[model samples]
Target: MEIRPMRSWIHHRRGEVLRQGGVGRSAMPGVYEDMLTRHGFEGRDAYLYRRHESTAWKRAEGAGIHLDLDGRLLEPTDLTDAGGNPLRLFYNPDGAVSVSRRSANMTYSARNADGDELYFVHKGTGTFYTEFGPIPYEPGDYVLLPKGVTYRIRPTGPDNYFMIIETTEELGFADIGPHGRRAPFDPGLLYVPSPELDDLGDGRNQDGEWPVRVKYQGGFTTAYYDFDPIDAIGWSGDLFPFKLNIRDFRPITSDRIHIMPSGHAVFATSTVVVGNYLPRPLESAPDAEPFPPIHRNMDYDEFLFTHAGTALGVPMPPASFALTPRGLHHGLPAKVEEELRKGIKPGTVADFEFIFVDWAHSLVATPEALAQKRAGDQLREGVAAQ
Candidate 1:
């Protein structure tokens, strides 16, 4: 299947709203208070109000909001009414749902879909159910669902948060040459619940039908389907739900020198590549120093979401993201490299996991994203000057 750069449809609309001076009425009763008094929203401020609103809005529109499926610019109408909901966003036209987990106590249903889905769990811990069984997932876990699978999420220990990328396209691993189907990364690593776990109280199947609710126009729309979302039955095929634990991705390395950035690839789609900082031995050869210059590869576009630890000597205060588009000369800044040369361990199992969703098709940054880029540069300068 052809891979395309995915964009967040919500961010584009939110940028429009911000450009248009916010949505709804700022003075109108806040969605929090209104939902609490009217819709029985009793969650904490963080859940009902704080961060949740923006998270929900972004998810509804799309995370990594790009243009559109046809590569056209996304407009406001492209976004569904994700307002008032605590944890989900529904897409227009296709009815695909993007669920964002903002709190640890959040529990929601994973209903059946007419199309396939890709879920990236960014934070928190939880138990996810498929028609087969329940699989426990933690932060940085990615899950893929085939079309028509029914599932639900239960945040067992703590409130967890994650982002789901729903699409009609079937997502699979990039084809490896000669190896054919059995690639280095086993498809089974994606984790389906065992039969023992499958017996965990009959999952979310309600009499062969699953209850799904959608938001359309300005109200709630509920629909019941006649088949269980997970009715894949006994079909063994390449296209199926899989999960890859980001932590389990073993990075290839060189014993005497740092490998090239492409060596850091954990996964790649047709147009996108996910890279990690895997552990490598320090290159201390004659005339070779411990620090390696940031090598720029122009073959693909790269966006790094800093999942953990400091990377390239840049002090990432956790959960912060950095983007290095194709042709952008990004590497360890000079001073940080100096520190590494002074006997710092050259590698650690890349504590940092970032998604590099490149597109075989070229992409253009939205005007709003461009403005954010300018602001980011200004902030970087301010920090340096400080």
Candidate 2:
């Protein structure tokens, strides 16, 4: 809750501050002075830390992942129980990926890594057992596992599916200027069973061990260590798993023309922004454009994944994914706009269930994810076959 003053300056031909207004000549110097005067040494340190954190959050919030259309040879590992289907992994350049399947239960052990991981349950129900406690997750629930936090997953049903986004940097909430206080995807919105006690069942009756498996990369080879993955007993720290339901995300829109892209950000990390296109009324303008504008954004690489609706005029059958890299302009197809102009409510609650992952760093899609996109086409073909 520390507030910094604004410093305005007028620059001369030599790039020197000719005139200073408001507070000071530079924003940084004003901020530093404010920190030292208001907060003592300890407070100053906390202020600096918070400042850095805010910057990091902004960077991550503006970044995104663009879907890879080119098919490649990415790896898929099986971590499910006997006869259980395997969870597919789609790796991105920043060490982020998504896991999805019809009926698969997978477990990942806590380990030190160069990145942070996020789990979004698109469909299905399951429990995430962590050092803090067991958290029940379902479709639209987003969970984040900070780096080095130990945890595992236990499926409660047959069709347990998830979308995992792993990042090499810590993920956080986006900073919604001035009046914005709470995190875009506040942890409170994420439902953790009532009573906050382990009364669901025997905490030890789970099929797999408390600690499950660990995967790490070495020189020219990948190593897997198999042992009890849960060893975090009687330990406490700020790092832990937190879940937020996408449905609980409060969106900000406009009654006029257009809402800034930042308005669409639901959650963010160090280098990414998770945006939601919730169902809401568009700006009422008699001559308003029928579709959202295709504006060029430099801050993020946009990856739009269809969770339950058609996107950009494309009927994104379930599991369909698309990407638009930084500086790329994308919008609904022209024909879609024509349909909307004809007074058709083309947008629906189910049509806006897509998940957008924006990354600040350059991202390369894994072969497996590309294959999934290709498989989607095959699915369409199969539908045609019938």
Candidate 3:
């Protein structure tokens, strides 16, 4: 019988900061005990949770669950040289996700119309020949190729391994702010391939046999060329391939507080964000917590690929990959905390080099990545007891 503007129904008792008109916005009648803020609340995006506190260690139920990257993750990539094809790990229908391992040199050039590609060189050296030019890539180099760019990998040695991430969207560097831009080397230092247009002339493919496979519409169509595919007398455009070394990425740290994971982000798009945790000094404050805060991030599924160094004393070797789904609580173990308490030299580099990918949606874990997943019962039981 009453016509009034509908107000949020938040349950709150006196003395609660979340009470009606108290602190945060109130749409319901109860207090939201858990609040996650981005940009230290300056971003103005606050996620409120009811009866779900990420710090509730008692609810962090896990039993030593682990995804072993070296054994299980790499097992699915056992691509035989039957036809000299690369092994694919996973592919999504939306073309938003694709991971593959390439060892043998590629024979044909490829052009993807769906998205860009990022290749992490794990072993060997090679020259990535693209329409723009030739990029000499070595181990630890992250080479990025934009969509519609015809390119092929030419390995110089017999041993070569590559981790490739193909995304449906264009990839660009994160805002990173003035601080991150200043800490790392100048952005201009990134290596861009100079135009090396090599025309094979009319004799290279008189039979019109060389095919440049174009990927689109869920499949591929071959485009035959009378000459070599890398025939670009000269090219000019903002879109081109580039390479950056992991050693060139300098991490940003806080002297008095622990920096958030996003602080290390190097590149990102609407659906995915990529970060690099390079060797850096740990939190220098005597009482500061060196590890990330315990919380359940419901926004993105996190994937950590260990490229070098042990991650937070976890003994993560190179090529190790791990995925922590959304709503899961992951943090440093007690033993690690104890070790941190023992006192680390102020400038001691924690040697935690890894690539962190935060996907907006749940990442589809391949069966091979799930093969050797360790039980999380211990973590569950420990959290319950707490």
Candidate 4:
């Protein structure tokens, strides 16, 4: 890890106390609060009190990309052909995010030689037939398949949607800190399959080649076998594929302050951090914002898939998702900010829910995503409606 410089200083303001006489407070009357933070809101921060919206801009022409995509419209190749795989959405050296709309059972098994894979079930029920065993999946579940582990997914239903984050690094559970794992989720809630050999059969076409496709460095290598290769009847190991549903997550909340996103991290690797933006009690402090702080995260890029609910006045359709590149100021949509500007009562609830993944480095979107990109701003969702 690169050493970040540390220094000692006192925070002094140049402007008058618009209202709360403090830093990082959200919209109050005509004033706006914008924050610049390091370490994903866990480190040093500078809150800017402005007379205007922090997310406002005259125009963003090039690299100032803030993307909002409608995943409900994406047509992944896997939806039609069994030989097809997830359609690449965004990628960088560390990882890639893809979407799969597969409606059929796989004709062959596959393995990722590059890294571990995470499949966030946006919709549908299915079973992951892996070498370890079979793990059934449903909407709102996160299925993790370790690198080099052979697996294939078979949908139990016809309509299915999945948001997948496949990375080139090892994946593990996030530390629950002093609260222990029971706080966010109980490890016991994880559905880990043991190696069991039952109903295991040859490929759909038993008389044909049963191919084991291995994906490495964005290329596939097929090894055909006359007989099925998933022959493990018993195995003993801590390493295996598992599933965790979002409904079981208990996100920490505070009525006094808006907790940072990192506080919601359920999974992390050296290169990525995955979190659930579940509904929780909003801040009730008389002087604080009820929503997340308006922030320009200096380090990581954020990717969010809205499973349900309207967020920041943005009515989320099925499979709604957004991307806020690192350094881009983001938070509530402008329309919601305006509502906050008016005033909010005590004990408000944050009803919005989504699954967010943060990459330590930047992500490059695929051509498919670029073709239908929507120009977004903090207010665009609301502004466009007008």
Best by lDDT: 4
lDDT of 2: 0.48
lDDT of 3 by residue, 1-386 (tens): 01112333443444434332212223333333343433221232333445443433554444323233453245323233311334344345323433444444454677888678888777678788887888998977889898899887667765666777777878887765568455655677689887676543321222546667777764787787756778776777788889998888887777667677777877777667777888888776655556543345556666677667754454644675666665555554444444654666687667766777777666665665555454553222221110
| Per-residue lDDT over 212-298 for candidate 4, one digit per residue giving the tens place of the 0 to 100 score | 989977999988987677777777878888999989998887766666777888888866888888877666666655555456888
Query: On residues 283-376, what C-alpha lDDT tens digit does candidate 2 reach at each position?
Result: 4454433243323345455565556644333454554455555543344333333454455342322245767776666566555555654422
RMSD of 4: 3.4
The candidate with the higher lDDT, 1 or 4, is: 4
Better of 1 and 2 by TM-score: 2
Report the C-alpha lDDT of model 1 over 1-386, residue by residue, as the tens digit. Answer: 13333432332222112122112212333332111111001111111222122212222232333221111111221122211133223333322323354333212234434445566676667766665555677877877766655566655544444545444344445432343333335555667654223333322333544445443342455566654344433544454456777666655544455444444554443434444553345455433434333333344333444445534344544433333333333334334344545654434332334544433233444343333232233112211110
* Model 1 segments more than 4 A misplaced: 1-99, 102-116, 163-169, 175-190, 194-210, 213-222, 225-238, 279-299, 312-315, 345-351, 362-386
- Models ranked on lDDT: 4, 3, 2, 1
* Alpha-carbon local distance difference test for all models: 0.40, 0.48, 0.60, 0.75
* Candidate 2 local lDDT, residue 202: 25
State model 3's lDDT: 0.60
Provide TM-scores for the models.
0.55, 0.64, 0.76, 0.89
Question: Considering summed lDDT, which 10 consecutive residues are worst modelled in model 2?
Answer: 33-42
True-structure RMSD, every candidate: 17.7, 13.0, 8.3, 3.4
Q: Which structure among the candidates has the greatest TM-score? A: 4
